[model samples]
Target chain A: MTLTATSPAPAPAPAGPAPDLAALAARHGLVESGARPCLPEYTRRLWGRRHFVTAFATARLTAQYSRARLGQLWQVMTPLLNATVYYFVFGVLLRTKEGVRDFVPFLVTGVFVWTFTSSTVLAGTRALTGNLGLVRALHFPRAALPVAYAVQQLQQLLFSMAALTVILCCCGQFPRPSWLLALPALGLQATFNTGLALVMARLASRTPDIAQLMPFALRTWMYVSGVMWSVSHAVRGDKMPHLVAVALEWNPAALYIDLTRFALIDSFAAGQLPPYAWAGAAGWALLAGVGGFVFFWQAEETYGRG
Target chain B: MADAYDARTPTVIADDVHITYRVHSGRTAREVHAVKGVTFVAHKGEAIGLIGSNGSGKSTLLKAVAGLIRPARGRVYTRGQPSLLGVNAALMNDLTGERNVVLGGLAMGMTRRQVRERYQRIVDFSGIDDKGDFSTLPMRTYSSGMAARLRFSIAAARSHDVLMIDEALATGDAAFQRRSKARIAELRATAGTVFLVSHHHRTVTETCDRALWLEAGTLRMDGPAADVVAAYEAHAKAKK
Candidate 1:
């Protein structure tokens, strides 16, 4: 698009030779408009707006339930209802609960943990498209939208965790030393979800049709992630190909679900949590978290532009 | 008045900037050249007016300077972040005006403490509470004029390096127009360069010392605001 600079034709006499305007602007420390900052500076700017990210997330979460009659109760009720429905379908009808111990606690924990990742991914898909007004109106880091959506989903999950704890207590599962492990496991899962959310944010921002197709993809992923049944038992019985079994074991969602179950359920913990499980969780978090952040940051300047 | 600002300190430099928009219809794409090699230099403390006929690329040029749009060719350079005023006022309608003030302040890069400090002043400046406790109500309930006033008040709260306004001042009551005009003067006294895009030539002639006139994607005139407006008006009369 480069062309010769055709100076505007005006009658005003120059004091002397017209100095190069571009050179003058450069000498004065002016930078190109709409240019993306370097990675380090971008990170610094995003870090500086941490409070904005949290405030925005909290505001959106509050607004999400404001119009409903039950208001914030839905945060817990939605997951509880989903868990009940899954139990009826898989545990009762299909009798998938036959080999599973503490089926109620197992199903509730899986639903709550899986909800965190699914909701986060869904929110990320709309982070930019849904808030086009804010995106076009403001000049902050675009990553703030997806990260804030991830935080909002995490907040919702925390509420669901309280309900899950009550259900576990009802199922006669008392707290043990292994329960302390749930914190780090959640931290790793949150990181993984945030990273994946960032990836979805960029993808959906470009092709918003991806947002429509995401629910189907997430449903398919949930079925294979072993949310309702035992992945280990099914694999041990040789019901699937070896490669498929290995993939189901290593799948990030299943790995996270297993990590939470190992932390919260005494019966699951007694079966011996594999050493590779923790390693795989950490590996997925690092891969998705760091990779997704840089991927999103690469297109920072193009977020709101047509 | 001309000597008040240091001419050597340039705040915005649009060097042969060309902005083009791609319009897609059915199965064809058309390229519309909005701003063709428009170049100008703006200095600190100058309130420059951008006056043009409809579809003359005045708003497009301002967006390019604000870094909202990238020039397809050439470049625009600025001393600091150039804020486009009214667009930032596009806040959440479901949110209360009080919450919108906080959100808008943070969106403009203000710290939470700064927003808290300026909260009362912003509300007071908008005169939103003159009749009742309107700031507590959702912004959707507000009249268009009131909403515009609040938006202008929020943006005017912060002194920016380069501020680009697009017909935001045309709304509001006469008393409010007077208050906002004074606020613009206050912003200029702080050495901020202001770019005002308005269809009202009289407003341009009154608020700005210099003006840029664009026609058919080219810079048609650049001089004193009154002179440019007069020239543009005469051209329009001749065209009719």
Candidate 2:
């Protein structure tokens, strides 16, 4: 086992004239390391990891508030506090709630639903960057990170929903058959948010500065999504340009918020939901869900690499 | 060295792999050619040690083999997904060690039931509870060595086709080191290829049958472990 020490060690001899190593590996059923699987295969792998996704999400959510004294209570309390601030600013100070009915219920529902999208998008921006250790150490679908973050936000939204329900009941908006409509509405929003999360995860993996910029972008998006004001009421008549009104109505964030609002609030549900509301919700979910997935998958092999 | 692994069946092949990292410093980007056209083939049941001085690209080459970093010029092929266990592969620090075990096991593609079955063994292997119930405490509360032990334990609980370890064994105490070496041997007995990168030349010679020595992002020596370690040590002494 001994060899004479040399300053520049000689290269090892080729193993039988190289012998087409790639072909040999292929013949032995080897696959290229880090190669992106085809879409169906990638989907299958991601589906296989569904349990991991949920567990990872739950772990993160539980650990999020571990340092705070109030702990998990903050999950519901955070959104309730946000609604309180928004209610004061818009309902009392600016009087923007003048035209809207059941202002508290509307505001609370909008806050809960909008928080789902905003937090999911924000989490997506950090998904790959934040979990680089996991990504580099383990071999799994990269989509799992963003998908798990979306699930985390959905869980947080559920906590906020419990609070939202109590607030709705206090405001005299008791449950009705229409409350079931919120289920499909939320299901669509969750899918849409998951897709958007996938897109953001891929983007932020490369340009991590996007994470620094995302909060401002999401805040601006929140304002336009009608979290604090009703898009339909603001767009009524010539108060805004027709195209601007149409764009606001069709905005994915506003569309989800509006769908949930229409389903949960008596005032909003009493008025006929525009015929296109469900169509728009389904459209955005499919577009973002499929498009964002494909977008994220295109860069699968490149996630942890520099 | 095991009858189960036929020496002819190669488990990993690196065909002229080159990896370059563009490190961003302020507004400018600089490209560091980390692994330059490195080529090698590892067979099943073999434990290979990667030996190099600091910044010699041993870790980079290991990462390339693990599929975490793509080669810029060539390709790496493996019989199955290669898992890399590194010092930096920290699990969630804020979560309890128990939760990390579960999460790490799942991340390695273990079924929930498998994780449940192996949970106690994994904790006992880590020795995190030898003093107290440290497994229930947050990982941040454990010492760095304890965390490394736990990480290694979780990764070792499942057999992998190819496992690349980077400086993980250097942190553990002697008893843990002995246990890990035994586990690595057991892994080889199951026909898995193992790649270890360590600064301790003796650990390499004792644990691996073969060695790959990289110098300045290029492979310098590839041979029997004792020979490569001897050559590398003599080279280091000569330079001093």
Candidate 3:
């Protein structure tokens, strides 16, 4: 009987006298469903469920620090604390701030922006596997989980952005017209972070150990991306190979950090900024956002299944 | 029920569905064929009971029917989305019972306004309100029975096209089970197809019109609930 069901596809021509059960089942709306929804349809469904995504993200964020003494204030405190540590180590002790103007503000901006992407990537790794119960019991767009995690991180970043503004003001870097550019840059980075999260969500759902290994990988990425030290100053065009220097200059994270610094800081020379940084930001965002989404959607039906 | 089964549109059809699980124990990895070639057609307004002992693949088969697990060989077709009643189901442990009701209802495809409208009734139906402000407390603070009852209430709020209840009814008291059984009947009256998987023969016989008996991942019998339950009981008696 099982053989009959499995073998009906390759059987002789359909002109045979007996009506195939498989054909009958198909006619009666039976479908073998490991196939994912089409791109347009999946996007529509995901958009329709935006309320659920936002609500879930908000609920998770609210509960995230509820147990702590300061509650959501920890969102700002965490990065501020990290920025302080980096300021002491790299700014004071190691003199990473020697030639850099408004080093504290630059360090704070880097810490805040880098945390957004790194936390989003880490959270995306567990989006599906972490919510197996919800995935198994409910039938919604699974992409909602990862997208919600990204949204949660974005919300936290927005909260921390408030603290960042204050730090910049105290450091005597008043708001400039260029500071408005930080908005679009953050938007681009959010897109890139979401896409990276989607990719990591898919990967970590398949190999959960990726979640365990992401922090170290992200730390190395942080080092190379100039989160603590300026990659442009550390690796000069004359000192390093041209291709390597260009790659470092064009690194998406480095580009985003530099864009924010250009917007906020006065002494960071415009010539020091990577050329066409906005284009680079947009290009990386589109590539990762669209490619990562499609890559994740292709395996939509397999998520949360053992 | 028989007439409806004959006359109503088919809501679910399982076509030789086979579900396999990969089990890794220490060093050796092996495939466990949980559900092998079990196929059945369920029509609207039919309450079908899935009964088998431990390791019988009843839950596995139901998971396939709910689209939670993809079949290794065949497929399961449904008229609409099938909702599975899971005990823990991704509800945040730190959220209060009321908040979880909103989340669970939303997760089960209810709109925010719909969950809001049904909030009081869901809590009342689950009887969690009887604990005097317990519904306001975190879910982790509730007993397992209270949590299970709340989960059931949230799931049963909407009329599902196909509802699969797996072992959730057993977590409640007798009165709670009776109310859930009646709720299943009301769902059938609304032309919904229900698949109930339970080890309790009494619950199965009381709630289902048809029964499918599975043994070692194979369909042993599919018949009227009473006849199948009697046969299953006789087999158990013989083994004992």
Candidate 4:
């Protein structure tokens, strides 16, 4: 993949050095455009390249396990290992004395869903800076970078979800027909993730420092989101911990997973949910989704800078 | 052959654009004037080159013109859209080159179907062989030339009202340069404009019809590519 900088000997070689690319582009007025890049225009541009997005996501999923002895099995093995460890640690060791029959399913479902949200938020935040190559050389809507990241993460989650469903059903935990409702809940989770991604991708581009703290943030969020232990169970059903109580009332990942459980798990019933929880979770999704996108778009042009 | 261009409709116009960056202090923030009161015009089918020393504000001026930076004062008006090209424009190492090219194409505003349709054209132009698992490999493992090839293919594959290229072309092979130049000419002939930024004097003289020498964000020289490039080259040589 040579650049062809040495070129066919110009019929007559200019005795002096060749000018740099910058001088050449400007001298010709390519940079002379004064028009601002509109967000819709940029978005439309990204839309045109959707296949590239899907292809990239597919490649990322496949390549992640290329070097592992386990190969693509790592995809399933990763979440399995994660669920097992938490199940042992929280379900057995700390136990917090949970009484939600077959807590394993409850814990695994919540963690897997939460992992999707966290991974999307974490990856999307740094999507811009991490892909400086694509951002600078191309003129597509910059949002595609982060959206692509989220989509890639979602692909990985789909595998995890399938494995989770099989595990739960195999364990005599067949869900009610109403469990199909989980799809919309999952969609809302993704919507929230996309929004969070947009904001993070832009902010992370401006300061690489933000990316460094993401893993730690994800870990903290993991605790807050009740991936291992149910907040509803931890505070003993009657009263919830301050953060966990608030989370149960709002966190979409929690709501979405609970929606799944309400349809599947026998303990959960209609009266168990608070009135504002649905509204609050929806609000969370709206804010993160719309706010993240708008925030990122404002810095759309800046990402191209070196 | 020179591009058969229509010069009546302006491709680009930056009206006395002033751009400043703020350096904040605990006491008071100070603005760094990256560019000030700079204006220029470009017409369709013209290749313009910007030549200047490092930190001479050449890149800043180019960025301002590319719509990457908003001017503190005045405005940039384009008859059509402009695209900026850099390594950032081409591929991300974490993702495969193939994905990057498609992404690059899409970023340029082609539809998913359009990217798929042009996939072969872009891949072929990149000239990377079937070896090296181009689909599976991340660009971080690619050689500088490989990266540039993909970048070149992605950016040149599309047409634009205006295109701003940074110092990326210096890394390309001669064949690519020729191919890219022909492509640029093709784009311009179709009512597009090209803005090339480089320190390579010969490329400017050969590829551009006009040249602007940016010195500290000011437009130092704006005229025929041959004349301005010659003056700038002579000035650079004298300074050395």
> List-wise, what DockQ does each model earn?
0.40, 0.46, 0.34, 0.16
**Model 2 stretches astray by more than 4 angstroms:** A1-19, A270-272, B1-7, B86-90
The worst-scoring run of ten residues by lDDT in candidate 4 chain B lies at: B1-10
- Name the lDDT value of residue B104 in candidate 4: 64
* Best of the two (3, 4) by DockQ: 3
Cα deviation of A237, candidate 2, in Å: 1.7
Q: Tell me which of candidates 2 and 3 scores higher on TM-score.
A: 2
Candidate 1 colliding pairs: none
Cα TM-score per model:
0.91, 0.93, 0.91, 0.80
lDDT of each: 0.83, 0.85, 0.81, 0.70
Assess candidate 4 and give its lDDT. Answer: 0.70
- How many times do residue backbones clash in model 2? 0
A best-first ranking of the candidates according to their DockQ comes to: 2, 1, 3, 4
lDDT of 2 by residue, B116-222 (tens): 99999999999999999999999999998999899889888877788887764545899998898788777767648989899988889888999998889877788
Q: Write the per-residue lDDT of candidate 3 for residues A1-306, one digit (tens) a residue.
A: 111121123223233223243554455575544446699999998987887888889889988887788988898787778878988998889988877777898888888888888999999999998988788767788999999999999999988888888898998988879889889999999999999999999998877778889889999989888887787686764888888888888899998888888788887767877788889999999999999999999888878665
lDDT accuracy of residue B211 in candidate 3: 92
The candidate, 3 or 4, that scores higher on TM-score is 3
Top TM-score hit:
2
DockQ of 2: 0.46
Residue-wise C-alpha lDDT for candidate 1, range B1-240, written one tens digit per residue? 223323568898887777887665755767899998787888877899998899999988988898877788778889889887753434677778898898788778889999999999999999999999999998889999999899889888888789887775546999998898888778767647999999888889888999998888889878888888888887888779
